[model samples]
Target chain A: AQSVTQPDIHITVSEGASLELRCNYSYGATPYLFWYVQSPGQGLQLLLKYFSGDTLVQGIKGFEAEFKRSQSSFNLRKPSVHWSDAAEYFCAVGAVAGYALNFGKGTSLLVTP
Target chain B: NAGVTQTPKFRVLKTGQSMTLLCAQDMNHEYMYWYRQDPGMGLRLIHYSVGEGTTAKGEVPDGYNVSRLKKQNFLLGLESAAPSQTSVYFCATAEQGRNQPQHFGDGTRLSIL
Candidate 1:
């Protein structure tokens, strides 16, 4: 079975500050990983995904995540987060058998002025 | 394009009541999924379909049923609603591949009172 873990429950950052959200997964083999963002009253949007490519993957809205096999981590990062970046972020892993995704408990981000 | 849409953006159900949530996608995707989102728990897959007329159970499939009678639509049913089933439900679709991004719909906020 595949599982994902997000260490942070909530994160607060000021406008123009950098942001990073941690994500770790437990899977037997190299698995598909993804980052998704959910805003208030809206559906989730894909931030980025990692399959078998470069270790650093870029995503929408100036977000990026690195896949580190040694640490079993795929942490999302942003150089400078805007106020609009405040939202809930989720990390997910997928198995090859049925394309079912195992998601982590999301990290709620709050951007302050 | 209305990438993915879910009907009944909000609903309140009493215990033991039965209802179905409809999800439609305009992207001609071959894979669809149903997931429940709780307060602290991210998104748990309830059911999924690889294609039309093919339904499969996910991480948490008990007390829930899904149908994909059409390639563009997927429906999730709750035979007897329970308080524990009260949560936001999201529908997602993706291309049939290893690492395709899954598009989501604005969730249905279902409250089982």
Candidate 2:
């Protein structure tokens, strides 16, 4: 079975500050990883995804994540966050040939002014 | 394009009541999924379909049933609503490849008393 773990439940960062959200997964083989963001009362939006690529992947809204296979992690990072970045973020793991994904408990990001 | 759209953006139901949630996608994707989001539980996959008429149970499928009668639509049904089922439901669609990121709908907020 595949599982994802997001260590941070809530994080507060000031505008223009760097941010990093930790995510770890347990999967037998090379996993398809994704990062998604959701605003209050809205559905999730894809931030980024990693299948078989370079270690680092860039995403929308000035976000990026690095896939560290040895650590079983795919942490999302941003050089600077804006006020509009306040939202919940999730990490998910999928099989190489599967229809569903297993998601971790999300991290709530609060962008402070 | 609408990408993905979920019907009845919000609904409230009493315990034992039944209702169906509709998910439609305009992306012409072959894969669709249903998930429920609760506080501290991110999004748990309830059911998924790889193609029309091919439904499969996901991580948490206990109280949900799903159907994919058309390639562009997936429906999730709650036969008997319960308080535990009060949460936001999301529908997502993706292209045929596992590497493709799933696009999500705005979500349906369903509350059961």
Candidate 3:
């Protein structure tokens, strides 16, 4: 069984500040990792994903995540935060050829001016 | 392309009542999934289909039943509603292969009184 853990339940950052959200996964083999964001009352939108390539993967909305096998982590990072970047973010892991995804408990980001 | 669309964006059901949620995709995807999102609980997969006429249980499938009779449609049914089942349900679709990203619907907010 695969599982994901997000250490932070809520985070607050000021505009123009750097931000990083931690994500860790427990899986047997090389896992497919993904980041998703959800606004209030809306469905989740895919931010980025890491399959098997460069350690650093860029995503939409000026976000990126680096996969670190040694740390079992795929933390999402942004150079500077914007007010509109506030949302609930989730990290997920899935097995190869598997149709299901195991998701973390999510981290709610709050960007303040 | 309308991507993925779910019907009845909001619904309120009483305990013991039954309801079905419909999901349609225009992306010609071969895989579709049903997931529920609760506060701090990211998204948990309830059921999924690899293709038409095939359904499989996901991480959380106890109170949900699913069917995929058509390649572009997936239906999630709640036999008997419960307060514990009040959450946001999202439907998503993806192509058949590794590293493919899943497209999500706007989600249906369901509340059981």
Candidate that would win on TM-score: 1
Q: Which of 1 and 2 is the better model by lDDT? A: 1
Q: What is the C-alpha lDDT profile of model 3 across A27-74, one tens digit per residue?
A: 878889999998887888999999898999999999999999999999
Residue ranges of candidate 1 with Cα displaced over 4 Å: none
TM-score of each: 0.97, 0.96, 0.97
Question: Backbone collision count in every prediction?
Answer: 0, 0, 0
Chain A: TM-score in each candidate? 0.97, 0.96, 0.96
Q: Using lDDT, give the best candidate's number.
A: 1
Q: Who wins the DockQ comparison?
A: 1
| Rank ordering of all candidates by TM-score, starting from the highest | 1, 3, 2
In DockQ, how does model 3 score against the reference complex? 0.74
Candidate 1 clashes between residue pairs 3 or more apart in a chain or in different chains: none
Against the native complex, each candidate's DockQ, computed on alpha carbons, is 0.82, 0.78, 0.74
* Residue ranges of candidate 3 with Cα displaced over 4 Å: none
DockQ, Cα level, model 1: 0.82
lDDT (Cα, 0-100) at A66 in candidate 3: 97
Report every candidate's CA lDDT. Answer: 0.93, 0.91, 0.91
lDDT by residue for model 2 (A9-104), tens: 999999999999999999988989999998988888889999886989999999999999999999999999999999999999875544577889
Per-residue accuracy of model 3 over B1-113 as CA lDDT, tens digit each: 79999999999999999999999999999999999988877888888999999998887899899999999999999999999999999999998876787889999999999
